[model samples]
Target: MASIANKVYLFDRDKNLQWTSSIDNLEDVAISADGNKIIAVASNKVYSLLVDAPEEKFHFPVGYPDAEWYEHESPNGQGWMTYNPEPPCYGYHLGDDWNAKPPPDYDDYGDPVYAVASGMVVYAKTVPGDVWWGNVIMIRHDNINGTGVITSMYAHLRDINVSEGNVVGSGQVIGTIGKGYDDKLPSHLHFEIRYGDSETVGIGCIDSELVSGEQGPQGQIDPTWFINTY
Candidate 1:
């Protein structure tokens, strides 16, 4: 539970330092509404780390089969470059507006987005709009005590496969990644988990007292409780 700053770090369950290094700038630190799980966003990839997995080593540059876009700048300001940081492959970072003329295809957005765990759908939105987050969904899960309970969320969906009031099982397909509501950024899913009611979901407002408060509509839970870190 150390403050999530710009660096990527590893720690033991006792909060002892295990390893540390600089990834891309840390965008956000999402803890499952429960207190046991965490997902940190660094540039294009999401790193899921669990407090339960304190003894194992975790590294970035997820070894996916394909290389995604990443930004890098020249030392002398010649220009920005786009490259795959994945080893054995040499890619460069493209400038900020590199894809302004020809953007990535819709199909570039990948397949089925799944539920992190079994839960009840408390909120789901499918229509297009101007919000920073496009289509979004929120679910509530009952976790064991000590971690309290949690609420899971998925956003920026191209398609919503589930509806409000629906009960879903773990790994259920809920949506697909799509363009941001602004149509500027590429297709990506803005997934999150909070520990309170549906209204507090995805608002980026982390509130304490969720565990002790009356389970109201705006409470929050950390997101780390459900994600499996490997």
Candidate 2:
């Protein structure tokens, strides 16, 4: 049981004080339904800390601790940015097609794909040509500002380094870029984050836009806002 002024404390099932932190203007305590992370929402920002990890901290899946990539915009008419490089449009297509792409070598073959955070590999599959996202990997995060059972998914890979039920550390290389398609759709990583029992697989994934209120909570989060992409 450790805490400081304006701090939030987390307890384990055994009633042990697992983790705690001090925050300014600590607001309501939000617990993940899985009880893996505890979020402390302050006045201006949010704090996400892992519960089981005593010495390790959560990190961005890409571009941190010596990793970088050229962030691309959705040219296929997904103008609205999302964690997933490719946006699966929902309802009807309003603008142009959703299969947008960047210039050549934007995402080359064998481009390294990384695990967004340290978590257990709940789902992993490698089936090239079976679907647009030839290979898919879903990782359930330990905690993100107390967001419970949040998941990060990587798709359209040519190779998969990890398998199901494997425990991976943050920033660990799990796969590589596969054929992202022709010039219309370059080889890039299709990534996304989900909360709760949301659909990790990108099977016809057409999520609604920001604050559009058209889609459910399956994954309304913008990955760019959650991670340190810049």
- lDDT of candidates 1 onward, in order: 0.46, 0.53
Error of 2 at 190 (Å): 0.5
- Candidate 2 Cα misplacement greater than 4 A, ranges: 1-60, 63-67, 76-107, 127-130, 180-185, 198-217, 228-230
After superposition, which runs of candidate 1 have C-alpha atoms over 4 Å from their true positions? 1-110, 126-129, 144-146, 201-226
* Candidate 2: tens digits of C-alpha lDDT, residues 92-170: 2211111223474353567666666566676788644453556778876654445566777776666889877665656
Give the Cα error of residue 87 in candidate 1, in Å: 26
**Model 2 whole-model lDDT (C-alpha atoms):** 0.53
Residue 65 C-alpha lDDT in model 2 = 36
Best candidate according to TM-score:
2
lDDT of 1 by residue, 196-229 (tens): 4453333432232234323323443222222333
How close to the true structure is residue 199 of candidate 2, measured as C-alpha lDDT?
38
* RMSD, one per candidate, in order: 17.7, 11.3
